[model samples]
Target: MDVDLPYRLELISDLPGHDERAWQVAWNPTKPLLASCSADKSVRMYSYRPSDHGSKSLAFSHMGTIPTGHTKTVRSIAWAPSGKTLATGSFDSNVGIWEREDVSDSEDAGETAGDWECMTLLEGHETECKSVGYSSSGTLLASCSRDKTVWIWEVKPDADFECMGVLMEHSQDVKCVAWHPSEEILASASYDDTIKLYIDDPSEDWFCFSTLSGHKSTVWSLSWSPQGSYLASSSDDLTIRIWKRVEEHEWKSVLELRGHERSIYSISWGVGKGASENLGWLTTTGGDGKINVWEITEMQHTKDPLSATLIARISGAHDVNDVNSVSWCPRLEHPDLLATAGDDGSVKVWRVVPS
Candidate 1:
């Protein structure tokens, strides 16, 4: 495979001005909108359309900006499974869901020209919500906070906006939580230097089915493979580890990926990860000003790979700015695009220029 990348710098879009660094950006799966929330105490949406068939993503236009009711910084943002709603968690220890209500042509058409409003505000976590995400089915919203716990909330069958359950498991602040694409299990990484697994089983209490240990520092982020059988985690220890389950009784770490020179801050699994025919890749960004993609190959988990193949190295994307988070677009209709946020005050979009 041969391709030439100029390593060029291009500005895709200028988002709304933030009073401080933005923490996260999420792409809507069912529309052409991108949502970002930041220290400015606001969440805004920008509309983007390809100027031409093969044009690089530039020329994004601001559509609408919503001033959230929270007085603190927004920590994380997640688009609902249907893309009709968005979830945001804040440093104020509150999570809010925003839903789009289509304005009919006959019902005061000129009054408002937007498709979204805050539908609900959820309160349970006692400290700042560190992470929030929608499950694969979107019926559940999982949130973790500085209070050292994660809660799983189920939407009510009758009430359009209602919270149902709370999961109390981890003994340390849960840094991140990820839902498996096809299973009911959820994986979370914590500052306690351990990973916990939770499955929604009715007969038993919401407890850690297993605790994975190996990281030498705080765990920052976790992502599940597309098959929902494996988990990838990155840490301030400067390592990324892959974990895969064997049968239903046990799980094993298959490989440890290493390359970044600074503390690893964020990571994402490739959309096609965990397939028999494809080499599963994990992309990580850190304070070192480098983005490394690790190619994983497993003969079997029983015999872990001694190392991972470094498939791609990108620098200057965030550089000294310290990228706060990175997310691979959900494995849906488009799999080539990825979004990242940082102290640089921008969300950059990248596409894999196939080799």
Candidate 2:
């Protein structure tokens, strides 16, 4: 736990265009692409190419943009694991499913290429949908909203989706929902200051398997370790809590990371070089307009006063605006890269290379 940072974080480039705050930025799981949503009611996509060896930044070119279709702010965007579809949640209280039409097969390949079509809209959420995520298997999508509910949808062929379950378990606004990296288990964070884990039963019904409660204020986001053994949650309580599965249907708080002076908005776990078992690094963004890199060790979790060490920090990471979200590029080609969105309406790309 006491070592120099193995990686050096360098701000590479910024993508700016949104007229309002950018709420979320997500990296495509299978492609060199990034998608971002904003309060300006649009979703933008950028394709990344590695820069020259000695260049200080990565290269990301604007591919295209989905029209301003959402009547209100677009809060979240998620790409299916297959890289063929996208789901976006908005303040308009609706969810949009977008698919790329196969335009390359046309006789005139130049005219119809790169066509993205809105396949369908899911309109069941009664309030602003805060987040949307597809399960790792790509067969299910989960969405949570201010209406205090989480909805699971079954993905059918040809963009057909069926609402499988409506989980009305949270007592306050449901802020974010995330699927486990390797399982169908779903986790939702809420304004009630709790995170609930759910799984589908043999009857095809989703049920709460466990509730993680420690944050003293609203739980804003949840992220699972790449190995699927631990869960991390950020909260308005200004702390990030790590939970370990101790037994079947049970989880225990293993570490409480306190550093940010204000509400912690987002957290993401990434693969690190020489990552020990249940030990690695993570990045956190918050209302304080700072980004922090933390090192978590499983050995520390076994000791009293378990905690993670802050390895590095960037003050004013977003030019005095809250960093709303941070995501590590999951593809193998760019494992050391991170993308962040901020209230300043920009998406930044940062490279974390071994120092």
Candidate 3:
């Protein structure tokens, strides 16, 4: 089988905002907006739209900052599928929900702007909250923490949220929680070196359907494929593992990508216009301060177990700092675009151009 080789991911620009480590970055699902959280105890949003004047280079302008009510570091952020709401998890052991409000002024000639307001605070975790995520339908929210538990919240009408259930399966700290791309299933990674999958059935309720246990160390982050069939996890074991669903409630590791010189902190899968039968492309960042693009061919990965290959790697991606997170632009117009954050307190954007 022929493959696309030697993909080039060129750095477009560095977006500086935070005074400390930027822990996570997320792209809005339906808008040209990007959100990031940092250890500085603040949240920042940017307005990003590629120029149509024939230049492929990208630029992001600082839109505004939200002085989040949290007293500690904001570790993770996720935007609702409708791009109308944002959720942030913090070390203060609270989750803040932000809603976008339209701003208008007569002196500005009736032009409109966006103002994000802290709508409500969800508090229940015993310790630091590490990650927060919203389901594809935006009706459910998930958060995991150092408390070794994952909490699912039901988004009710009139700015009300209730804890639907709590998952306490991981013996160690839960690092991240990600919802499936299409389904209501949820996956959480933990320091117990395992990934647990959960589903909500009307009769069975929310229960762990399967446990993916193969990583030798802490699983730091997870990213599900666009079709919700495959999941990629990065770990302190210094590798990125790809798990493909075999049975309806079972999954197995099909490939282990071992190239990062240090702990792999985050991984993100690209999104495009078509339903890719393969894994398409994935980007991973780690303590080594490098970003690697892996081209995956899962057509026979269920039986082959060696279907992914590294196509491009950018060294010193965050300049000697631990790169914390990596995410691909979700917009259909710029699927090849990527975003990365690091301990150096900067967010860099790149274009993964295929050769």
Candidate 4:
């Protein structure tokens, strides 16, 4: 721990519910709820509120658990932009759409009280589904699989889905899929050490518009900056790469960040509590059991390279266990809050505080 660091990660609480390695954690964009999925084949939900003990702290309570009913591990979970629906992708080769049955106080300020039911089961991937995500407008959903393909589905009324495109562009297992923060464009990372960008063609189907090749090893995750001008990718090569949209259809790597000694599994970019609106914060963690928070400032001029500064870092964040996922809370009121999942089967909440 460097005492001189400008920021430090303050322990908030450990959410104890998942009984197996937790794969991912997601913050509800429109609610005070947090969700985690694990190898236990279950999804855990927790509700959080500002702590009475301190203004910078949050208190979390276990709300409920969804069995998910997946025959294998629930690999990934994503909340729809509306925060009313959750999509779960599993090693069972299926994607499940879930909704709460109890509408009472559905608009309440606390945790949603209801029985979560799988509204639809989407099956097309021939192998394990690795990741799932929803577009900015909640109109489109994307899923990637070990089948080396990405699937785009249209979110229809009545829990129905229509397959818009089946992208077979990746030569190896697709590890993760993410949509641009405010666009219909989708990006998929693969074990082939590349990231592919896709967009819908009005006259045809969704197609890959760009293939970003640079990482020497598997590309594990992708996150778009809050403003959508940049994309950050973590890789098995133990580095995070930043790509800039230099042209309408072209993107080039502008920066490479190296700190982790092992594979970087997950990276998340969020609007930070910085003084400038263009300053976005990126959090990343992985096999090294460490968490790194970097502050990225958008370039003032088009030709200037993006500036990145490591504002805080904590090693052994999971106590000798691999930190599988890290997510920034989406609520603007609590921009410094973060939630992380680990192989130790625990979800921990943290807050970035000035040292």
Q: Give lDDT tens digits, candidate 4, residues 238-257.
A: 99999999998899999999
lDDT of each: 0.72, 0.85, 0.86, 0.93
| TM-score of each model, paired residue for residue | 0.86, 0.92, 0.93, 0.97
lDDT of 3 by residue, 1-355 (tens): 0134567668876889899999999988776678889999888887765556657665677778888979999999999887778899999999999986774323221124667789999999999999999998999999999999999999998679988899999999999999999899999999999999999878766889899999999999999988888999999999899898888888989788888889999999885322366567888999999888887775543667547767778888888899999999988778788899999889888887665
What C-alpha lDDT, on a 0 to 100 scale, does residue 31 get in candidate 2?
64
Ranking by lDDT: 4, 3, 2, 1
- Candidate 4: clashing pairs of residues: none
Name the best candidate (by lDDT): 4
Candidate 4: where is the Cα deviation over 4 Å?
A: 104-112, 301-304
Highest TM-score: which candidate?
4
Residue 196 lDDT in candidate 1 = 88
Q: CA shift at 348, candidate 1, in angstroms?
A: 0.8
Better of 1 and 3 by lDDT: 3
Name the better of 3 and 4 by TM-score: 4
Q: Could you tell me which 10 consecutive residues in candidate 2 have the lowest summed lDDT?
A: 103-112
Superpose all Cα atoms of candidate 3 onto the true structure and report the RMSD in Å to 1 decimal: 3.6
